[model samples]
Target: MHDHEEHDEQDSGGGAAAPARAKLFLEGRYRKLCRDLPQTVFYCPECKGHPRRRRGCARCEGFGKLTRDSVQELVGWVAGKAFGTRKHKFHGAGREDVDVRMLGEGRPFVLELLGPRTFQVDLAALEAEINRRNEGRLEVRGLHWTERQRVVVLKETPHAKEYEARVAVELAPGDPRAAQALAAARALVGTRHTIIQHTPERVAHRRADKDRERWIEFLSVELEPEVEPEVAPAPALDAAPELDAAPALDAAPALDPAAATAAANGADAAPARTYWRVRLRTQHGTYVKEVLSGDSGKTRPCLAEWIGAPCRCVELDVTAILDEHGGAEEVVEPAPADDAPFGTGI
Candidate 1:
């Protein structure tokens, strides 16, 4: 993604001489894309995803792979075509499960164009094209040129991320226990909690089996209804509360967290299913899913433990990478590495 050595001195644009190396930067805005796609090319383990396998692989219907879609392939294709080369590397700050959606400003990445023959193109136009082709799927933002050194820095620099998670909950409607969960979640907002995580069960087969410490910096918590409530009709002008209303009722009803959400959304009844929208800030490489499940007790002080009930994150969206100026980590000096485009894909 970024080479340590400065390549900017060379002509990366109009100069006649071929540029030593050129890289493109893009922040991928994934709204709904990648839900069913992998971050990189997924080769079938059984047949190596080789299309020409002597015995047609029934698993992949002889196509040799499970899915043809991936964030890397989609973004890489446009850049490769524009740059006139297919050789590149994907360098991401971190990765998310394919089931997760990337949102907000999108994830930053560098695509290293290896041995580019066409040194330069209109970046703005290229960005527009990428978005147009991937409409409703993914969008590229902050597209520009950068040094290869950034790739290594991006790799080494720890990324703190924010996510919006929809979790399935088991608490009964109007359960007094909800307050305990609410209080526990709120207590984490402005503090830090160190957690010990074993290699998550899902990735244990490929990742090293070991214990790792990660931190959870809580951001926010909210109760979400399964179905969004309709906005109530505007109140009659005369029915509006007086500017100076009486404060006479001493036995006012206790606050119902769901009531607040319901009043705002116009619903008078609870949904059939209960869900909570919890926003979390976590260190790079932390197992976010495990933070909720405790991975069968491997992760301590997990969300499950905090709320004293079983919960699972059913939907997730990345809202931010809080490592740059906007977040906790200081800006890292771009370090060097290969010349291929760094695609910081999950």
Candidate 2:
């Protein structure tokens, strides 16, 4: 009986030892598999020499150094894993000429960083990193955590813009016609069908070689003294009793159409001559440069064609952008009813 009990105990001990040895072997095999796996096989910058199941590898900090799509994927993963949400969008203010540098305040813009892992980010440090990486080429400011709706609003809103450009012109000297031409340009209003051809010189690579119709409304123009100025009586004199009081001489009758047409035809006989400083307000995506240049005769009734001279926008500036579909009309105040008593209902 004693021998049998001793045998049974030995059998139990052996059974326990077998499992211990197997566990050790399994752990060793797992560690070897992790170590021997090549980092390139994973193609993850952060996962080199790390277990596949690890939360994140210290080497790349979970960011794979690859295409922008990779960055976006990693951002999505981080947001989902850390914050349990997903929201983000990119917004750029007034795009550059692709080659042109946007100087001064770098254009006012707002980026809505939404549903981030942590809205409370070290924005100053992030800005520093971006600036450092870009070498001052691109900069960002007012980097605050915001909502997704704000991003939509930013994209939709028509932000006012300002631009400065130098233009070349073919102009004559010592002619009064230029002043009239500039006046006509400034007087134009509303939408005008101006067709523009996409040329290989400027925008062929990115844009399709097609024609686009755009609207341009000239806000104002300033012309050089190519002609002498004509002086008229001051407004105060016109208002004085000497000439004004004569029963206000009913407003002059409208001119006959025949006479008007004759005057217009005569006005076009002279050649235009002057450099102009033109200011305009227009909708987004209207190619101001092409409008000014006539785009090799693509623009109809253009500044060049209108004046019958090779004309260019000597200087151009975008003063404002009018929102076409802004909102409901403003509520106007109702005029008080005549003969209504004070504090009485109408």
- Which model scores highest in TM-score? 1
- On residues 141-207, what C-alpha lDDT tens digit does candidate 2 reach at each position? 3333333344354456654333343444465555566556655666663344444545435656557
186 Cα displacement, candidate 2 (Å): 3.1
lDDT of 1 by residue, 1-346 (tens): 2332235453556655543554444333333355776766777777877657815777776766677877777778888888788877777767778788888767667676665556546666777888899888777775666666667877787778888888776676577777677777777777778999988878987899999988887778887744666999999999988778667698787889988988989697554345788888887778888898788988987988988888788888888777732385443323132232433221
Per-candidate local distance difference test: 0.71, 0.42
What TM-score number comes out for model 1? 0.71
User: How does candidate 2 fare on TM-score?
Assistant: 0.41
Residue 263 of model 1: what lDDT?
Answer: 93
